[model samples]
Target: MDSGGTPEQVLMGGSMLIGTVGAYLVLGAYLVQLQHYCLAGAEGKRKNRLTLYILVGVVTVCETLRVCFITFAAWRVLVLGIGQPVLRQSPAKTAPSLHILGSFIALFIQGFFAWRIWTHKFNKILGAIAVLIGLLTTTQLIVGVLTGVQLGRIGAIAEQAAVTAGRNGVFNQFINNNQNPGGLTPFAISVGILTSTVFVCDVLITIGMFSIFHVYRKRSMAPRAKSALRVLSINTLENGLITSLCAALTLILYYARVHPWIHMAS
Candidate 1:
């Protein structure tokens, strides 16, 4: 590969692209379904349909933003300077910040939807868990941005020290041992934690969705309401699973630690 990636590295990169695209397709389909439901004008269900549309629309935007960042990173890695990591530069470096911001926006939307659903007869514990997850996601967003900025500052300090020390200082030692062209830094540990938190939130949301489904199956909600809940439950479950898988894949890629493939590409 032009990026000095091995064939296997190329394959893994390709897989990530395909998987991300597939996720966008699923999200897009659900958004369309939500719009249809919103516009169906089913008498008393207008509010519910509108709420669902809003929730789906926010999630769709988040997913779209994520895809854009991923595409930019991929392009940086594959087509730009062969040995330079794509994420080391200005716009590429901003991608994660954008993702974190988008996640916070999505978290707010998810929380609002969860709150609306909490008045029903479903498991209160599940709803509480979902709400807590949303809160945690918001925290992660804030922490992620702080950590990224801190890491960037550290990189700048290291670069300056490398210049002045002529290769014999603490900062130079840190740079030699810790710095990567990809801009991976110790602060990225926080990002890993944030990603894990997102996965946990997705799992909690899925649990809440299933709890609602179980309650609906046994209870006496209106026929149309029950049908709408079922659609939401199914879509939520699918989205949660996909989100969790993506988080796991990202962590794996981030922490693989050795750039055997990065070097091969270079």
Candidate 2:
């Protein structure tokens, strides 16, 4: 109904679809884990229980914010259809801030991976580097989101629904304005650093894990055990590659500026 460009359509629709599916998948996993823990009489050590609770809090907050974003977007569309000026005046006002939730989720998840790698007794230096990378990237992501939000609120960048009307030319013009208050250089630099560091961290973890698994497999005598380890290694490698690819793609789309919404959704 908005008659937006292909890129805008893809971004809006893709975000809706992903948000729905991702929420379900993530919450479903948490639900299953919670059920199992309950059935086991919550027998985990105190430290483990504390960690689980903290993680649950993080996931809950993230998912709740995501739902709010989806709801707000849908409401804007509906209001626009009904011929309201409110949406046009304050389009996507909350989205940039809300999007920071993704970075938080990534931080916690990546920190968990780092912890796992540390538990394996990998080189202490490498483990420290991985943690540092994760922290830096996450911090950069937050800064980028906040910067973009500041720009968006100041009219430096168009809102979510603004592009939906196929007004990309206006958006481009804003970006090109020499005296524009919100310069994109900082946001671009932040995203570049975050994505690069995240990719590097994931790669290091995957390689370290693979090498450890390979060593174990060679020493393993049981055929069944070796086969299981092979499967695990493959899964680990695939997950790492997928994460790296996503970060790379997000960075490309962002720097290229072909479709900023696409990168934001990523």
Q: Which candidate has the highest lDDT of all? A: 2
- Which tens-of-lDDT digit does each residue in 168-190 have in candidate 2? 34333333232233444444554
Q: RMSD of candidate 2 to the true fold?
A: 5.7
Models, CA RMSD each: 6.3, 5.7
Q: Which has the greatest TM-score? A: 2
Candidate 1 local lDDT, 10-117, one digit each (tens):
653555455446546655765676676556655445556666667666766766666676666556545562565322222245334444644565566557645655
C-alpha lDDT (0 to 100) for residue 163 of candidate 1:
54
- Backbone clashes in each candidate structure, one number apiece? 4, 0
In TM-score terms, candidate 1 sits at 0.63
Look at candidate 1 and tell me the lDDT of residue 166.
Answer: 51
Can you give the TM-score per candidate against the true fold? Answer: 0.63, 0.65
| CA lDDT of every candidate | 0.55, 0.58
Question: Per-residue lDDT for 74 in model 1?
Answer: 57
